[model samples]
Target: MERSQEYENTAWASPVCDAQEPRLAAAISGRRLPCFGRARPKKIAEGVGSLNVRSMTGRSREVADLMKRRKINILCVQDTRWRGNKAIDNWEMGTSSFFSRANKEGREGVGVVLNAEWKKHMVNVNRCSNRVMSIKLMYGKVTINIISAYAPQVGCSIEEKEDFWEQMDAQITWMGEEERIILGGDLNGHVGRNRNIIERTHGGWGVGERNEESENVVDFAVAFDMAILNTFYKKQENQMWTYCSAGRKSQIDLLMCRRNNLKEIKNFKVINGESVAPQHRLIVIDFEMKEERRGRQQQTSRIKWWMLKDQELKAEFKIKVLDRMVEAEDPDTWWTTSSRHIIEIGEEVCGKTSGKDPSPPRIRNLGVE
Candidate 1:
């Protein structure tokens, strides 16, 4: 009976109970077990959207409200038709809107809007041209570049289309490999539902038939190693289309991101029943930004060894430790058992020091006084 009780009280019994009653094992062994309930790494879920507002003349508040209602963090609006290159902050709506437009009104214009949460992280805004503009934001260690573009329509001259692509190519080529890029725009082209030759850039979920303008979009994606997000998700015709006009529907507005970052995208779809614009619907993509975990500094506690100077306390500790002592077959077991008992008894007899610097002893200056 004595040997059985001794064995049950030793560290050997801890392993069996550790799997079942971890708290009980920890108490019996006088050691703390690792906690498995640590919090998971945090992730930032951001919704980036694109819309052709047609004209954002007196509808800034309306656009801001739409963004807030839909929980969109970043929005790229094309054909804003706002003159000059400047930024507008709507305090009541909690959005920062930036636009780049031609000197004349009612013409080509592009803009990007950020919610209050993302506005503080904005590094700079590049107004490349009336048809293209970009905003750079620092998200932890990653740099996110969001470009808003308005490509020329089929009715426009060949030179106008070429110029727009040239500007887009320049902007894309300027971005570094490590930076994350999300291009949203009204490219006014259809990539179609086929993924035969351009499968690397097109995701095969596109709508309608490919056109001449579609080649420009696909070739750009292939050259830059980007994935056209609109053609990646399978959705119904209504959910897939971004534009609706005089008895016609099309998916002209599009979103694109780096091919390597496709895994970060969670969902992409067009929002229906939204009346932000008469012809265009809002298309959004949900993606996650993983926050880097910071290393924690280990905290240590120091035992108050000097408390043993109290003769009565030291005697009590020694007696308690001697009472708990037991013979062990091995040196390791003997040392561990003896040390644990000694430390336990010492803690009971003499308290520990707080992990802080103690006040200095009063200085004696009898001679100086």
Candidate 2:
């Protein structure tokens, strides 16, 4: 299931969808994500209603699982080295994405993705960093802007850090104050290892002064009044640290909204397996979506597949497939709660349904054991 990033397969994304991906075989070749976190935004759109955010830590298979979970809507990643021409279906039943991969074939790049059907409503503005993707969303005719960002390693000099801060300042200001904005990603900066009480502002960790680059991000967040939800980690000891590095841990990846109604972080394995080879864990964000597709509609694409016969028009049929799966027989046999758990990804849909009395599922045909 290993895919490549190149001039062709523009819609191609990460390699984390399949466990068979050669990249994750750490014992095989080069550093899995050596040039991962340095790319810039490649594609964009407006109205990204909901998303599943994560610092991929260079695993595409996990990215695919997150897509299938029906929990988070969009995903943000960092350090995705040499990612291009990767397959979306291989990751999830129905999923499509946009991404900026490592710049030098095995180095740095960045990208973003919206289910094709939802693309028309949103538009993306270009900036620096495969680390950042800005989406303009229209909620009930109300516009909301979101920026998915990732800062660089704190190894740069103070002068260089100042320059990055200036650029970050300009990009954020460009969003303007009129619209609602939610900015999330891995800042890679923390106040300190210990969650000490902050007298001034910010609840959780702040960026460290490893170098000037990180200091700039920390200072900017404080100046902008961006609330760090993970600050409340002390409130919920169970949820902390989106990634574990060198055996030490810290909450590097973040999810910050303009207005904080931060309910609860979904789970660690939202889009990944239970292994730790990639070095990072998955993070999911769940908030109210502005709008939901009410009925069946038509969509066209350039992708090809077993279901899509047309050479030009490609349609995501995952939703339709799951709907049928649920209605096949004693719905309760293969269902848990409700069919509302549908995840309409790129070209397909997959999800677990809930029934009144949920006790997992007991399916014989599909081998539910």
Clashes of each: 0, 63
Give the Å shift of residue 223 in candidate 1: 0.5
Runs with alpha carbons beyond 4 Å of true place in candidate 2: 1-62, 83-94, 192-201, 204-214, 233-238, 259-277, 289-369
lDDT of each: 0.82, 0.47
> What stretches of model 1 exceed 4 Å from their correct place?
1-41, 91-93, 291-369
lDDT by residue (41-108, candidate 1, tens digit) is 34454699999998887878788888889999899999888777767775444565554555465577
- For model 1 the TM-score comes to 0.68
TM-scores for all candidates: the values are 0.68, 0.50
* C-alpha lDDT of candidate 2 relative to the true structure: 0.47
